[model samples]
Every structure is written in structure tokens, then in C-alpha cells.
Target: MKAENPKASAEVVWANNNTDDASLRLWREQSRQLLLSEAKARGLQSTSPCLCGSGDRLRDCCLRPLR
Candidate 1:
């Protein structure tokens, strides 16, 4: 499913097409926030693995977006 933000798709494509860590990080942070929000809405615990499937705890992942 596509994200609600139209620009997100373009940004993802651009980030994938280019080897830019800044852009990629920005996209990743946005994705993390979205995933976290969705998971919270669905009553998922923060101690659970991130909804993004990174295998890290949701609280840890979202709290430290730079990682």
C-alpha cells in the first residue's frame, strides 16, 4: 500500500536512485514515525519489534531515529 503522502513515493524513489545518506535517513525517519504511529493506533506495545520489521524494539527504534 502507498503512503498517504504523495511526495513519500517520489522521495523513496529518489533516495533509492541516489546514494545519499541524508536523503535516505530523512526517509527512514519519516517511515519510522509513520510505522510507530500506526502500531500505536493498533494497540501494539512499544516493547515489540518495530512495525518496520527491523527486529528492533519499537520504542528503541523510534526513540533513536539516527540509528
Candidate 2:
């Protein structure tokens, strides 16, 4: 199973009224945009990934080479 959202632990509260595909899709797209914006704001290169448990900082010692 996929891991739950650490930031959004309350599932029912967030997905209560919306019980349709369109609502779910909109939520997903908004979530994606939020994540991307947050990543960009943190100066994390979109190409490289942070894997050392230090979030996505580029110099966090777990920065992998960009593909």
C-alpha cells in the first residue's frame, strides 16, 4: 500500500464532501502544484533528488546527479 500523507493525516476531514472523480482529480492536481511550488521555493533542483533523509536540499550529501 502507498504511504499516507504525513502532512495530511486526517483523510475523512479532507475528503468528506467530495465523492466524485472530478473532485478527486482536482485535489490531486492542486496537491501536485503545491508540492512542486514548495520544492521550487526550497531551491531544490527539479532534476536532482534528495535521498539522505534531509529533505531536498541540494548540498545535503544525498544529492544524486541529475539525469
Candidate 3:
């Protein structure tokens, strides 16, 4: 099962009702952009190991662009 968002459910609900696929896609893109910006802010390199300790490089894992 996918992990639930660490953010509040109500917050997500208010952002863009998860019931809609388009809304979900938009939300995910927004989240991804934010994450990339944050990584850049911290000087995290694309080739660095993932912070998740998944034994994969960032570009090959979390830092990869969304599908």
C-alpha cells in the first residue's frame, strides 16, 4: 500500500479535491516542483544517494522527474 501523505488530510482535501484525476496530477506536479526546488536550495546533487537510504542514486530514484 502507498504511504499516506504526512500532511494533514483536511489540508489536501481543501487544496484540490482528490476525487478528481486532473486535480491529483496537478497536486503531484506542484509537490514535485517544490521538492526539486528544496533540493536545489540545499545543494543536493542529482547524482547523490537518495535520502531515503534506498541504495539508489537520487537521479535514479526520488530526484527523477515524474512520469
Highest lDDT among the candidates is held by which one?
Answer: 1
lDDT of each: 0.68, 0.51, 0.64
| Model 1: CA > 4 A from native | 1-17, 49-66
Give the per-residue Cα lDDT of candidate 1 at 36. Answer: 68
* TM-scores for the candidates: 0.46, 0.47, 0.54
Candidate 2 C-alpha lDDT tens digits along 11-57: 55234664676776676667556655666787666454643355565
Task: Give per-residue CA lDDT, model 3, range 1-58, as digits (tens).
Answer: 2236554234443244435877666766886787678768878777777665777876
Q: For residues 1-67, could you state the per-residue lDDT of candidate 1 as single tens digits?
A: 3446665453333335555878767867887677767887988988988765779987787556534
The residue-level lDDT of candidate 3 at 30 comes to 87
Question: How badly does each model clash, as a count of residue pairs?
Answer: 0, 0, 0
User: How would the candidate models be sorted by TM-score, starting from the highest?
Assistant: 3, 2, 1
Candidate 2 backbone collisions, by pair: none
Distance from true location, Cα of 9 in model 2, Å: 3.2
lDDT of 3 at 5: 50
How many clashing pairs does model 1 include?
A: 0
Per the 3 Å backbone cut-off, how many clashing residue pairs does candidate 2 have? 0
Which prediction has the highest TM-score against the true structure? 3
